[model samples]
Target: MDNENNVNKYSKEEQLNESRVNHDDQKLTTNQGVGVSHTDDSLKAGNRGPTLMEDFHFREKMTHFDHERIPERVVHARGFGAHGHFQPYESMAELTKAKFLQDPSIKTPVFVRFSTVVGSKGSADTVRDVRGFATKFYTEDGNYDLVANNIPVFFIQDAIKFPDIVHSIKPEPHNDMPQASAAHDTFWDFVVNTPEITHMIMWLLSDRAIPRSYRMMEGFGVNTFRFVNGEGKGRFVKFHWKPLLGVHSLVWDEAQKLAGKDPDYHRRDLWDAISKGDYPEYELGIQIIEEEDEFNFDFDVLDPTKIWPEEIVPVKPIGKMTLDRNVDNFFAETEQVAFHPANVVPGIDFTNDPLLQGRLFSYLDTQLIRLGGPNFHEIPINRPLAPIHNNQREGYHRMTIDQGVTSYSPNSLRGNAPHPTPDTEHGYAHYTEKVDGKKVRERSESFNDHYSQASLFWNSMSNAEKEHIIEAFHFEVGAVMDKQIKERVVEMFNHVDGELATEIAKGIGVAPPQNPGGTGVTASSPAVSQENTNQVAATRKVAILLEDGFNHHQVTQVMEALKSAGVHSEIISKNLGMLTGVDGQQLEVNKNYVNTGSIMYDAVYIPGGRQSVDNLLQQGDALHFVNEAFKHGKTIGATNEGVDLLVISQVEGIELAALDSQAELVSKMGIVTIRNAGDMGTIEQEGYFSQQFVSAIAQHRHWKRKNKKEMVPA
Candidate 1:
């Protein structure tokens, strides 16, 4: 096994370096390879004269710059991508004949792009929208793209309504006001009219919409696909990618704050994690059912707005994917890599889901315009490892050279070579499902139960999760200036959960909605909630705000422990320069108060020292940092004089411990303190404090402590 693994690794390395040899010793030159002294300026009559047209350098440079940008994606414009490998945990020969899944030893190279659905290319990361989790596998068969999303369900039932749904959620046409947000009149108005979107609206309004990090979020294909075995037997399957770190989210306030504090939070987290060898891992799980049993469920299996409950069909883990490499260039790789749901291998096939069917056309059409013509597949990043042979050739940016008399299929020309392969012999064959129905524009009755699963999702959430959902609804509805739209939306959601609608209405200072009714389906799936997800402290960032005369020894002890535990800790002060510690040790500050804020970090730590506390009090932003951290329910540690700052600021709900006492204060409330810097030895052993902090960070907010009053300065 070791020898085989080494051989495969060597082959991959060789392939990666295959295109690098040409540039090894090449000198800098233009496209013509003419060595020029200067490339920055064009040949002119004089220094301040008009540039001459004879200077091809300037013409070429300006021409390239003029056409540098292509059309951005109509949806999911903001995205981050990484390189990775997909390895099956065991042979899935029983389910499919796809080579990538049939071999446990082979590591198929993959490129994944994570994106936001509605935001443009320049929008902020933390927004209330479905995240696009698309992966392209360069398998020996071809490029297989598992285009998915963070949510399992989509807004529209059919592809025909996709454009309408997108248009409604996008900025209002009259005035593009609200970029990267759905909290507006048009969105709610659409929701009120479109009943099929209720289930997805529940997901969009939940904490799942505001993921803490890309590494911690779950991914779902959102559409049912088919798996065919060698014998032509097929089964319906839904794909799921469960993150090892588990699903987590930020508080609405925290997300809003981070948008300003760190707009590149998710992208930076992914890049930093991969660079540090803390590669993000996700398990590929599939919910499979017999093709004949598709009608056995209460809802239409082909409906994109519905989900298969885990209780009915368990998710079978098939493989694991680790994103271990960051892209070399954002434009060349991340921006140009195209992912289409229709890119399937022989073993995998598509279903007749309206949205999925539309996506099959949309993705290819989008690439043609975005990547320039039909040759996007020829791009290095989108190219497959296997050889591509076809009579279809030539387009804008064509990279391949076909040297044969035959450019078209069929006939005795070229001895009828490059012929099509039969399905029985390693060829893709569509499943022979009988289809005989009258052509009509209508939806299936099974797709009508939009409120049941939405209610199930509501019922599955934990208390904290439910509170966050209510807060999200309040936030979104509060932003709607139209009173009728807000009322209509609340009334529409009342059918999902009367309690939720009433609570949101109260929070937003609106009248409680009248009960429109429910689906009367008393079922809850615990898997739908993030509270039951796996939790770990790995890759969580803790900001240690320090100033001159800080407790160097205590700070170093805590920082070392956190670092050893895989928690990233950075010292933030009022300046980027070094500050003298209490013991005269100079500690380097990574960020200053002007650049960094508590919202950008997972937790906050304030080391004790008289001068440090004085400096914190003197800086207004530093005091607001502590106040904001406290309000957000982040885990905060302050020993000795560090506690003095908290007290001086009169931060609400803080229970400080007496100096010299090791008794932990607010042990179960997410706040931790050792009272003295010398008592740092027991910090890790304080399991109670650890549990509290972890739970607090996981909850992401303490909405119950809603004190409208501002903090008082002592």
Candidate 2:
């Protein structure tokens, strides 16, 4: 009992180490712990003939390697995870009796997994799909998994239609073409047929589909849940995870380019952020409604396809979660960790939302087959901080060692141990709500109005955001071979907005709908727009474009200023190694032209030197780097002779700084440049070049460029 208490309060890191195996200084051996002599060559007849079948070492090695992999998840197969802790602002004893929510001093250890829904395990990280943000909190009561997604709504209202939507989004069966993308014929066909999926389809076509980084996206539990208090009263609630950094996304061109240049863009961003101590943080918010007021809204409170507008029911942020540690091993921890919506503690219970009810049963059933057994909860990543005990035991992969002869409960032979507790104790109690409904399998009548909220989503998008949505629809529906499917899609979205349907019809070669109904509800939720999010320069990566004989004096000042502001800068050149500046000072090149591209970075910067800029003018890759960054709405900065490259790149969106050949600084539309930088700390002075450049980088991207329709060669 003393030893148990010593490790009882173990954090997730300490608990995970109990199952972690270190092979650092150990000798190589077989699975049975037998020392091996050589593994390079297999046993054969006379060293060159057929291998001997009786060779136990060769057979065993080949057999294990062949069967090493288990089944991947049906959805959200490609994922990355990190370890973190959740801290509440204050006790929420009045709202709910949840132990973790009632304590402000205690930090609950957690594991968070981020993923793409349509892709396989081998898919790219920057795909245009829903991103899963599942979190498992190892609290004192038990493991509570808040399964969520980057988007606040879902594609289907009923659970039975889940399999159908997934099948349609997957590659067509006849020819398994278009890996890890939903821009295909079958997907569009399903969207037009499933009228209930209008709201989700609008989101899937918006900028939210392509995220800039996992650290800068919002997460939402896409189902209505119940929060039960100590007095047996229940309140309807929805979970939200608002990122501290802000909700940001990549342009379609940048996203597609990154798929080829850097497939692990989001995963690498998250890993580098934590490794450099720039931890990602998010706040836990809940939108709650009293049980009596549930039926007072225009839309159904239990509908999975609808979102309770922040104006109607404001989100009350009660806690914050910070991710500070990366997983030690990907497969052992991230892959093996199983999350279920059913893993809830006391005071957090389920509701009668049909989609939520179906997930409770589906998640548990899928884990058994995908994880190979029912004992997956024992895996280190999924194990809870609280102790577990039960009477029935001994399933596949069971690790517990039971000494007693008795396995059943309520028996005098084993002193009738492991007694149950009522609601007064720590035992879990399900919320008791009066229910009277027919045995019909039909959906609720209130869940039938789907186009109204879909129109609300369209009405809330910015002009630029609306353009992106129309472009996305053109790309997704124009790929369809069937003319009927493409036309059906155009007509279906006409209910959302007139211009949206007309623009999509023009691009896809279909007739526009005449009378497009724009759901006359003049309400827009500002919370759903990314234009209204927190922005900062911290953790942003910028590529400093340079060549030999660059201006060290000016570049050093910019670098120092950026570093102080928590911005990461990497030197990109034609080749690797040291680059000598005009003043004999050398700068190390972290990335080369062939190894990196503009899509992987947030901004591009160039320092000034006459000879260096002249040399860079000769390289085609350097010119393309500037144009590509400009086309993607990224910030671009240059000083002195470096502005010459910008002019040669033919990007016309910002005013240059100059006065009759005299040195002057200019800042316009996220582009900062100077005719010349004179001395040390000159750019660092207040209201100077460095300040303007860093502030532009903090803007994340220059989305409001003047040349919004200009085409670049790159």
Candidate 3:
């Protein structure tokens, strides 16, 4: 193969670098690369009449700007992307012949796009909606795209109903009042009418919809696919991407506040984490079942609205993917990069899953319109790392310059060049499964049982999680003005759990169902609960509430401890400048109360200093910050004189350290307090105090504090 066709000779980054332009010291030019001498004024009559068409430079500039915007994606429009690489833990040649998963020594370049499903390009990031987690792997065989979602189950079963579901959940066409929210009448009406959406509604109302970070959520292939091994053995498979950081979510209230305060909160978090070298990592997992055992499950393996309980079929970790580089250009890369489920390699194959079948067509069709034309694959970000020798010719925005005269096959003049690779040579061959089904538009009976997994998900939730779900239902369902729709929602969910329906009824002003139906499946999957996830202090952010006259030694000790634990601490004061400590030590402030609030941080901390606390006690913003953090169940820490600030705030129930005590610590309900300023200075000598506080931060939130949260007023 020539150098141009031999992509393996250069790394993916190197191939992309061929197109990257510095533009720092270069002269301005038109699209044809012709130099432009004058651009400020168009060639016109007397410099003010109608612009002349002969002003080629001005016309080119205007034409490019006018056509700069493409049609935004119908769904998953609000997205962020990053460049990374995937490496397998060990060889998986026994299961599949996928080159990326068959060798631990190779790193396949990958691009991942994280997005919200039901929003426009300008919607808020913290909206309560299913998130899109799509990855494009540039492998030796070809580009393998793993199109997934944060939630395992989808709202609809058949692809034919996709349009209906999307239309119903989107804002009503007439008013379009609510932006990026499901709390409306049309959505509830659709839910009550579609019983198949019962299970997905349960997940949508759960905390999973409002993830704390893309780095902290799990991505599921959703559709059941097939894995074909080297010997032509095929197995049904479901792919999973598990974050190394435990799955976490923002409290509903916090998520709402963040939507208003910072619409780009998630985008900023990802960019900042990567810039700070805190690369996000997720392990790739696959749940495989023998093709013969497909009929053994209670629910259809091909149903998109069901889950193969991890308790039944455990997820096996296969590889890991780390997103270490952010995209240099949002529009050129993240927006233009297209992902299709049909973009598969030799090992990965598709199932007869109805949703998956529709996606195979819908994704490609949409990309053709969303992007300019059929040549979108030639876009640098979407190009593959394998050799390209197809006879495909020009289309809109075609970048390739073919040299052959015989574009057709079986031609003798060009010796039939660019011949197809046979199955023996690793060419993709579809699994040869017997198919004798009817042409009628119908679904299998095995996909009928939808409430069993929904019930299982509800039963698996901890008490705190259950409460959050109930509240979420209240907010979402209660927004409906039509009482019939609200009543139908309660009746529909009654099948999942009688108590859940009753709780939802109480909040939505509906009478409890006299004969609440319940699914007989009493089992639970522990893996579905976020409470069981691993918690670590690493990558957590803390707000250090400091002011003029702060304790230098105490602040230094706590900050150093946080650094050692891989936690990020930001010094926030009344102003964004150097703050003077009690002993004349100066500390730089990263943020100020005017620009930031407790909603931005995972926890709050205040160091010892009589003057600092005195000043904070008088500032309404500082007190509100503490009160709001406590109200949201975030960990709160105060040392010595700083303890007085906690006592004076709206926080209650937890006993704080007494002022006169010497080096005493009081840790309760995620609040850590040290009574002695001297003991805080001894943090390096006796690290127990800081360790306890760090452990509290690792818990993410102290839900026990919810009992008294209603009493606090921020």
Output the number of the lDDT-best candidate.
3
TM-score of each: 0.86, 0.89, 0.89
Residue range 1-714, candidate 1, lDDT tens digits: 999976775553353455346774767565688765554233433332223446565445444432333588778889999999999989888899888998889999999999998888889999878999999999998989999999999898766456567778888765676899998877887888888899998899898899988999999999989998888899999999999988888878878878887889899989999999999999999999898787798888877888899988999999999999999999989889999998999899977676675566667766877887899998889999988888888889998888978877685878777878887767888877755454334455666788888988888887878877888888888887667778887788888887788887897767887654665667889899887788676788888888998988878877766765567889998889899997899889899878888888878888888898888889887788877877776667676678777676546565566655665455435566656546464225655333344445544444445442234331
> What's the lDDT for all of these models?
0.79, 0.84, 0.86
- Measured with C-alpha atoms, the lDDT of residue 316 in candidate 3 is 100
As for candidate 1, its clashing pairs are none
Sort by TM-score, top down from the best: 3, 2, 1
Candidate numbers, best lDDT first, in rank order:
3, 2, 1
Alpha carbon deviation, residue 649, candidate 1 (Å): 3.6
- Give the better candidate number (2 or 3) by lDDT: 3
TM-score of 2: 0.89
lDDT of 3 by residue, 1-714 (tens): 687766564543443354255767788787899987654333433311223446566445544432323698878989999999999999998899888899898999999999999888999999999999999999999899999999999998766466667778888765575888899877888899888889999899999999999989999999999999899999999999999989999999999999989999998999999998889999999999998898898888888899999999999999999999999999999999999999999999988787776677668777877787899999999999898998889889999999969888988888888887999888999988765543333456677887898999999999999999999999999988778788898899999999999999999999989987789779999999999998988899999998888899888888888888888999998888899999999999999987889999999998888899899999999999999999988999998888899988988999888667567778899999987656453234444568788889999899998889898986
Assess the local accuracy of residue 244 in candidate 1 as a C-alpha lDDT between 0 and 100: 90
Candidate 2 achieves a global lDDT of: 0.84
Model 1 worst lDDT run, 10 consecutive residues:
41-50
* Residue ranges of candidate 1 with Cα displaced over 4 Å: 1-70, 507-510, 659-666, 677-679, 682-714
